[model samples]
Target: MLPDISVVLTTYNQGKFIKKAIDSILSQSFNNFELIIVDDGSIDDTKRKIDQYSDSRIKKVFKQNEGPSSASNVGISLAKGAWIALMSGDDISLPDRLQVQYEFANSFNYKICFGLPIIIDDEDNIIPDEDFPVFFSDHSFSNRKVFKRLFEKGNYFCAPTAFFQKDIIEEKNPFLISSLQLQDFACWLSLSKKYDMPIINKRLIKYRRHANNISSKNNNGRMEFEMKMIYKNILNNMTWELLHEIFPNQFSVASMNDKRCFEIEKSFLLLKQSIKSVHEVGCEKIWNYINDDVMCSILSTKYNFNYLDFFMETGKFNTNERDESND
Candidate 1:
């Protein structure tokens, strides 16, 4: 019989915590599921530890050290369930994670579901739950207001805590497996366009923030990659009219520089989309664009432009001159 859900986990050099990750899944309150773990070329004893688990529900695929994006793509491709709960090898999910998301998706008919994540340090100490901003139940998910909120800040949806319908990803083909970083944000931006974003509002996953994480080590590089992804995949695809309606904060020259970086990224994706014949203008890009310059500027500056204000005011195009102040 087919399982009710599929848990897709990707790992690289996670031997230290892979056991905890796997055990958490096995001990889940929701038992009727399959666990697909992709060991993305670990040179360590991660494989040996995985071998220690012999449950029939666990399936392991070994691949060369590709990246999380590729590993996840492979996992999703092999998933037989209608829903896939994305997880990481270094993190632990709450026992009720799948059960809660499954019930919410079933009752609400949500295509994608996200949740609040508890941040934990390498020593497994709770850092602070307030990393995620306080959210109201009536927050906008189906309209531009939602995208506006996301652009106003960084990613609000914790990737591992989120579960999505396999079919939604299959249909969009939005993920580019070649990218080793920012894959989660790229995928979420695409999903936001086609479906109403759902938040589980529960702390379902422990997001382990440690020095060993690939993201922590090459943060600047990852930010560069994310900026490139946004420009190619999201900004250029949006028409000036739609962008004005949805991402007005990007109008200023300075903001436009930021938007232009996204535009360049979108431009790249547009070229590929047209070439591949997967072209369709989304309602809005639905994702914020970032570039190396913008990323650095963001490091120096306090925040990006205000989305709601940018939407209402068209003349507020941020001039590129202001970026000089950053230098």
Candidate 2:
């Protein structure tokens, strides 16, 4: 009989941490799950480490070094369970993580769900002040309007914490092969456009931050470029007429760079509007990500202007200061 959940873990040269990752799953409180490990052409002793595992439920697939997206796609194709759980070789899932997420998904009839993760160092020690600012956090998106707005700002969910029904992937194949370094973010964005992504408040995974992590290797320019492409792709899929209707001034801009900045600003406004419409609190939290300087700077440089000046002229900073002063 097929398992209730299929856990897909993709590893490349993560030999040191791979064993811990696998052991975490094998020791999960949830027993009715199959663990699928895809080794993406690791030149290290990753294969030897995997070979040491003889769990009957563990399925190992060895493949060429294509990247995480391709490896995950292969695992998705092999999944036979009713639900699929995403994992990374360097992360540790709490024993109750799968059980909690699985129950939450079924109990609420949610197609996709994710939980918060505790940040850990290379030594598996929890970071004392892991409360660093992020785009989205601790809140759940139960509607398309709010989800789209949140996604437009940035990816807020931990990929390794994602737990969802298998049919969602089999039907849509939301993971994009082109999103080499950001397949999980792209996938979440695509799915959030159509489904509600509720969050389980508990921290289910120990997210390891290490030097060898894929995100750690990305330069600022490449990260910004990839993000721009993701946003552009999402916008392009919408009807041109609709996009113009939503962002008339942005569409009227002559320069492509200027247009991108305008669109980003428009997204920021829409996100605020959506938040105000749905939740009374946490609007300020959303703004933190929307008004991020690094993102604004990237857009400004691409569009040939001082984004700081734009912020000042638009009274974005002054308004926030005024609000805080009043408080």
Candidate 3:
């Protein structure tokens, strides 16, 4: 018989913490779960510790050094449950974590749900909430409202605290292999477009914070580039009405049906957010020209877009000297 939930716990080189993480899952109040452990090339005693677990429900997959997101993907692929729960190998989940989520999902028809994370230190002591950013766990998820919040407030849904219906993964993989730092944020953001992401606001997970933690720290400039690309992809697929719903003041009825105008407006949103690398206002057209190869082909092939005209229309193009030939 298939379990009701599959908890995917992913790790790499966190052998010291993995034992506690595994024990936490094994001791969960809910018994209808299969635990999947994806050890991503941990060069430590991670495997040795996992071997100590003789639980029949525990499934282990050891693969080469493929980063966290890739490891998560492997676990998600092997999940054999109606609902999927995400757990970090370094974090400790409370006893009722799965039961609370399962009951809530069974009652409410929500496709995705997240709980609050109580931050913890290396020795398993609780850290005060004032030290880290607060979790906006109670916000009700509406498609337009949540997308708007994600665009402005960024991700608030705690990653490993998430318990979602497995079917959504069929539509899209929740984890993106390339977005190491923003994988959870990107998944929530992407899923928000299709489902109402709710909050439990109750059950707690000990979100471990340490020097080696991958949850919060920035992984170089890759995050910035990934975010811009996320926005661009959303713009490419989202309806104009949905776009206006997210950014109400940025669109007019006349611009609603105009594809060219819509493209230009999306570029404006990206520019206002400083999503481009140059961090300059007037370079949206130039950024689109250089960054998006597909959009470049479409603009020239379909819109007959004039770069000079488009650049001048924004009115912020700076010039060394404003003369007819130079401008």
Candidate 4:
């Protein structure tokens, strides 16, 4: 029988946690789903453990070490369900996770659904005193509040807990395999732009934060790289006029910060292009941005102007900052 959903999980050397992760899906209240496990060149007993599972609903894909994004893409390409639910090899979904999300999708005609998640330690124990929600509720991710929050504070939803319509990914061509890093953020940002991101408040998955996990090991580096691309790809695409139209108050500050950051980069580039270009018409464009009361006020408080000073002193923009550069 064709499954109602395709649960795509990418596994590497997660031999220790793979069984528990797979078992969680099998034990789900909603059983009409295919558990698609893509083993991305696991050198450990990860594949051996998967071989032990005899369920007809389980589909396994093997590939060389191409990273999670490529594995997900392969799984997505082979998926045969109406919805594609994403999970990590180390994460565990609650028994009712799919039932709840599936019901939400069917009831509201939602194309994408995500929920809160409990942070787990290496031992698979939930964080101390973390109150996981008992029931699911509505949360609109596309609303200005949610959008602004996501953009300002960074990613909000639990990625492994997300369930998106298959057609959406097929149409958007989600998950760039080349990123090797922050592929989730890149895909999510693309999806967010095209669809109304809806989130459920219930904690439906246990997000494992282990030393061996890709994210845990490269958190800072990956975040910096992702932020740089987000600024260039997402923020740079927005016009100042459009920003004011979409974001009114709280997001206005974020938009101003984005604009200033862009202007600063542009000015630094122009300064490097030629000393004479500093007097060009485009050079004055930077002043126009700085002249904005809100941007100037914010910069007055930010002491890290090394980005601006680099070009002024050395006549070239330094890719490295006192802090790591995002891209």
Q: Output the number of the TM-score-best candidate.
A: 3
The clash count for each model shown is 12, 0, 0, 1
Predicted structure 3, TM vs. truth: 0.83
lDDT of 1 by residue, 256-295 (tens): 4465444533432332321111121210231232225554
lDDT of 3 by residue, 1-327 (tens): 999999999999889899999999999999999999999999999989998989999999999997888998889889999899999899999999999999988898888888888888888888887766547433766867777777655666778899998888754456778776677777777778778877777856999888554332244346555664555565568888888877888765756877766776666565564223322332555466645677666556654655664565455434331211000
Q: In terms of lDDT, which candidate is stronger, 1 or 3?
A: 3
Runs of candidate 2 exceeding 4 Å displacement: 129-131, 135-138, 170-173, 212-218, 237-327
lDDT of each: 0.66, 0.69, 0.75, 0.69
Give stretches of model 3 more than 4 Å off. Answer: 212-220, 274-282, 285-327
Where's the lowest-lDDT run of ten residues in candidate 1? 318-327
Question: How do the residues 1-327 of candidate 4 rate in per-residue lDDT, one tens digit apiece?
Answer: 788999999999999999999999999999889999999999999999999999999998878998888898889989999998999999999999999999988898878888887778879776642332221223655644444444444455667988988988744347866576567766766666557778876779988876554334365555555555444445446555544544453234444657565455444333333223222323444455456776555445552443264335443334343222111
Which candidate should be chosen as best, given lDDT against the real structure? 3
Q: Per-residue lDDT tens digits of candidate 2, residues 63-92?
A: 999888888889989998999999999899
Question: Which ranges of candidate 1 are over 4 A from the true structure?
Answer: 131-140, 171-174, 212-217, 236-327
After the best TM-score superposition of candidate 3, give how far the Cα of residue 163 lies from its true spot, in angstroms: 0.7
Candidate closer to the true structure by lDDT (higher is better), 2 or 3: 3
Q: Runs in model 4 with CA error above 4 Å? A: 129-140, 170-173, 211-218, 235-244, 248-327
